[model samples]
Target: MHTSAANELKSESLELLREYYQFPSAELRNRLVQLNLGLVRKEAHHWVNQCTESYEDLLQVGCMGLIRAIERFDIAKGHAFSSFAIPYIRGEIQHYLRDKGSPVRIPRRWQTLQHQATMLTRQLQVQLNRQPTDQEIAAALEISVAEWQEIKLAFRNRAPLSLDAPMHEDDDSSASLADLVPDNRYQSFQLAQEDRIRLQQALVQLEKRTREVLEFVFLYDLTQKETAERLGISAVTVSRRVKSGLKLLKKIMVGSSS
Candidate 1:
């Protein structure tokens, strides 16, 4: 799916979450969990190669964390759910690994500190208008520079260097570690799950016919002619709708972002 379409789905999930938050229900919670299962799978796979645990075991454990995040997430916090939930999901996997005597254990305190540091780094970058120095991050975390460095070093040591490690292919060409990982449909779906709330709301402002045309062409992945057939309009009309709809969406999205 195109990135925009994937973003649309994510926006829908967020809208559902908002509704679920206002009127808590077992069914809505279950649906929210189902919608976000990809996040669990992504985090679980992240640890799959880092430890000796089976993927299935890690996945089941990760789901528990996802459930906790769904229950605890505050829509009014103005934080992205994925950002808030990743720590929970990762914590669960890490706890499972530690409990089961995984060899690559990093202290829980250090791990928690590392997550705090990451969040602080972003805030500091914006405030400083540049990448924040390690000292600045350390201060924000209320830790000495040496302890912050130790936390960073320990977190690095916990994972094998694979994500961006260099590799050689059969033809002797070099590639990044990410290129070596399988880009399966599941990963594609995960990509689609990234948030794009502005675009989603902008789409909602479109006329119903235009919205339907865009959905059929983008979300449903249909050809312009096929979309026209389904909507009982001429192909030319579908093309016009697609163009005008996108123009309007871009305007709304850009204005909102600014």
Candidate 2:
């Protein structure tokens, strides 16, 4: 399907669902039941090997979750339907795993360490406006820096692998995560070069007076009044010119993007 048509259909479906949910008529409820069942079936299909339960059994369990979500949904809370549905869906899936006694548990020590690390990182970021360093994380987690290092080392090769994350193909058609990470060193060098080129281009685009005003205000870190005095213009005129020049530059940049 064309992207536009698909988007339209999705929008229409959501609108219809919202209307049905609000009214809660028999017909609307039936439609919701069918949709919930279909969603369960679709999710079950993806977990055939991982799940010992039959698809029908999984579907029934998932429907219980779907009903709970529907009953608890509050339009006044201003959350999307999918956001509210996720917890219900995950709960159902987890219950299935627990019932089957899946042997995929993380080590208890690792789980404790992971929880502590995560909480510490979040707290540090809230306080410092940046991610915590290893030393800071260790202090927050009440562990020695060496112990923290050891814990990190243990999990270094055990990172959760996201199947959907992008990978790069080699010339011989092999893929790797190395290609997905931004080449920060190379990108920084390119960015510096690009900024220099853009500044030169902007200067060329501006009138001499405007360029001089910008140079004094930016490069020399002069106040608008100082820049205005240097250019023999009022501060207001200097401000207006700077604003106009910025708008022009923004247009140029946006145009380049397109």
Candidate 3:
């Protein structure tokens, strides 16, 4: 399907899903579910034809993705659930395919480097409360910085393997993390949440008066006149405090993150 047509369909589907989610009558939910199923089948049918996996299996995985998309969607953000859900659905299907196919054996040296990098990254984050710098990563992994850089360069050259490789013939629904790409968008959300938390914490560390001015002006959405009256200050004084408090808070947040 054309991107425009797909987006329009997704938007329409999200609207229907939102209405069903808000009201949550079984009849309405069932109707919407059926509608979504038809849409999933249409998309999945095209994909399944190109792969060895059964169409029914792909449909089942797609349904799981749809259910997840409905549950996680936030209407306040003004994003269509379908747009967010497509990647999730595709990931799940790709996972299924990888689990059912033959695996490519990665070379021992590359596997070791990959494992070391992952472990060092995790250890650095735990100790420093953030992702490690290149030097930190190298030190933690007991490698020279130059060697670490070379390993990273070499790792980038290899193409990633498929996730749909089966563990064994009998296993139908299991896939390894090796089969999946990290969702960079999800990583960005995690970083944003951490930054927001750090900022809020830094705000709490401000002087009581400064914090109060900020809360009154921003959190409570008060006008300068109302804030002045509440705090027994002139409007001019209130505006100055708000500005000073904001500048201080920004400094504090930046300092804490660094």
> Which candidate tops TM-score?
1
Error of 1 at 153 (Å): 10
Kindly report which residue stretches of model 3 are placed more than 4 angstroms away from their true locations once superposed: 1-14, 25-27, 102-258
TM-score for each prediction? 0.42, 0.35, 0.35
Q: What is the lDDT of residue 53 in candidate 3?
A: 69
| Per-residue lDDT of candidate 3, residues 26-100 (tens digit) | 676556556567657765764564466678988998777666556645565465454555545655565566678
Candidate 3's error at 136, in angstroms? Answer: 45
Judge candidate 1 at residue 246 and give its lDDT: 64
**Model 3 shows how many backbone clashes?**
8
What are the root-mean-square deviations of the candidates from the true structure over C-alphas? 21.4, 22.9, 19.7
Better of 1 and 3 by TM-score: 1
Please give the ranking of all candidate structures by lDDT, highest first, separated by commas.
1, 3, 2
Query: Each prediction's Cα lDDT score?
Result: 0.67, 0.56, 0.58
What would the per-residue lDDT of candidate 2 be over residues 1-258, giving only the tens digit for each residue? 599985765565466567866786667655666655555665555444344667677677777766666655555545555545544654566566666875333456756987889887778767875546779988877888987876664453233322122211112222222222224564422223233333434444567787776555544445576566556788778777666665665555454335
Write one digit per residue (lDDT tens) for candidate 1, span 1-258: 699987987898899889988998989988888888889998776677557788999999988888877876778756677766766776777667768898765567877888888788778867875556668888899989988876665565364333232221113224232232324553432211212223344556688899888766655445566566567798778777766776677665566555
